[model samples]
Target: MTQTKKTAKILRCPSCGMLVQPKDEDFPFCSDRCRKIDLGKWAMGVYKISSPVLDPDVLEDLDGLRDGQSRDSDEQ
Candidate 1:
């Protein structure tokens, strides 16, 4: 029988540093704790925000704000 090889295609769980097998759905995190930590990093904006064109309401609000702010800037 041919054995399946595990490779770096597998990631260790960050929290426990467990070998967290490649087949696990949450392969790299090993448990919920690591996932939550990763999520917290994102929540803290450790990464820059992308443009909000992804949200129609945000884009509309920004457009409205831009018009008002620019009108004031032009008047000055």
Candidate 2:
């Protein structure tokens, strides 16, 4: 006979840092309150997703746009 071990994967709630299981009603969040809190943070801009501009051509265009805007402001 062979014995097998089962491991339950646990996750922490994003809002409260409470240990939660994937089978929980909230799945990622511990409760509806915590889920709402996370949503509110997003709505209030407390959390932001940032990605680097990896394209060199796009960076050059952005720099040119800034320069043009500054020149226009200076002319006025």
Pick the TM-score winner.
2
Q: Write candidate 2's Cα lDDT for 1-76 as tens digits.
A: 9999998766899999999988899979999999999999999999999999989999999999999999999999
Candidate 2 wrongly placed segments (more than 4 Å): 1-7, 50-52
- C-alpha lDDT values of all predictions: 0.79, 0.95
Q: Each candidate's TM vs. the true structure?
A: 0.44, 0.67
The most accurate candidate by lDDT is: 2
Off by over 4 Å in 1: 1-8, 14-17, 49-72
**Tens-digit lDDT string for candidate 1 (1-53):** 99998667555776667778767777667877788987888889976777647
For residue 63, what is the lDDT in candidate 2? 99
| RMSD from true fold, candidate 2 | 3.5
Q: Residue 23 in model 1: shift from native, Å?
A: 1.9
lDDT of 1: 0.79
